[model samples]
Target: MAIDKEKIKQAIRLFLEGIGEDPDREGLKETPDRIARMWEEFDRQREFNFKLFEEFGDYNEMVIVKDIRFYSLCEHHLLPFFGKVHIAYIPDKVVCGLSKLVRTVKAFSLRPQVQERLTQQIADFLQEQLNPKGVAVVIEAEHLCMSMRGVMTPGHITVTSALRGIFLKDLRTREEFLKLIGKQGL
Candidate 1:
């Protein structure tokens, strides 16, 4: 469904009032419009089409894209969580562009999300589209809800991973993927 910018603007105004801020103040008057526009830009995931880039390829080895930076809002608290994602897949007969892997990560991260679900969605999308022999995704993030609020452990990072097909069934394949991504203690 499409997001209603006007509704967002109205909501922001209401939020400011609820927080005891005057929405009509000179400095705050344009805040609602700015927030609405920001949401529109961040929500570009809705427009991304992953299937448009699938193509035949002779390569059959593991394709790994690591250290993809992503920023997302925590669904529970609406706080920011920023981190890196590492994705790997062993193709069967086709592959996608390297940039598409980054785009996939961006598409998923553009919304309010949990790192675990975001990891799984990326793996699932590659598994379904490329029908790869295996797919793996690892994400490490520092959530502001956790660090800036709750526990307040500023440097703490949460790591999550999703493995499918061979990566789930084969220990060695999973190990290799982890190793290639410079991850240890799997």
Candidate 2:
């Protein structure tokens, strides 16, 4: 859905006032506009252009992209969570551009989301788009909600994974993916 910048601006203003801060203050004057712009950037991910390439030769092997860094807001708390995503796919008849993989991560991460669903959505999107032999996605994130409030435990990383097709059926395939991502286990 399209973001309403004006509504965001209004909401931010009210939020500032609710928190006992003057929205008209010198330092806070442009905060609402800045926040609205951030929402616009996040909403623009739906239009991301994807470039695809058909399979060449007999090159059907596990293609992996690791350490794709991303920042997202936790849906429950609206606090930030930063992470790295590791993706692996065995192509069937199509291959995707390397940068597109990074874009895909951003497309999902630029919204209020949980780490588990984010991992699954990336794997599912790749599976549907490429019709791959298999797709694997692993995400590890540190949630500010846990560190900055509530239980107040810092340095805890939550790891989530989604394995589809061959990766789900083959134990060795999953093991190799974990090893390549420098993890003995998730």
Identify the leading candidate in terms of lDDT. Answer: 2
TM-score of 1: 0.94
Per-residue lDDT for 36-144 in model 1, tens only?
Answer: 8888887765456565334556678899999999999999999999999999999887888788889888888888999989989988987887788999999999999
Local accuracy of candidate 2 as per-residue lDDT tens digits, 67-156: 999999999999999989999999887888998999999999999999999999999999988888899999999999999998899999
TM-score of each: 0.94, 0.97
Per-candidate Cα RMSD to the true structure, in Å, reads 1.6, 1.1
Query: What residue pairs clash in candidate 1, if any at all?
Result: none
Q: Which ranges in model 2 have alpha carbons more than 4 Å from their true place?
A: 55-57
Best by TM-score: 2
What C-alpha lDDT, on a 0 to 100 scale, does residue 24 get in candidate 1? 100
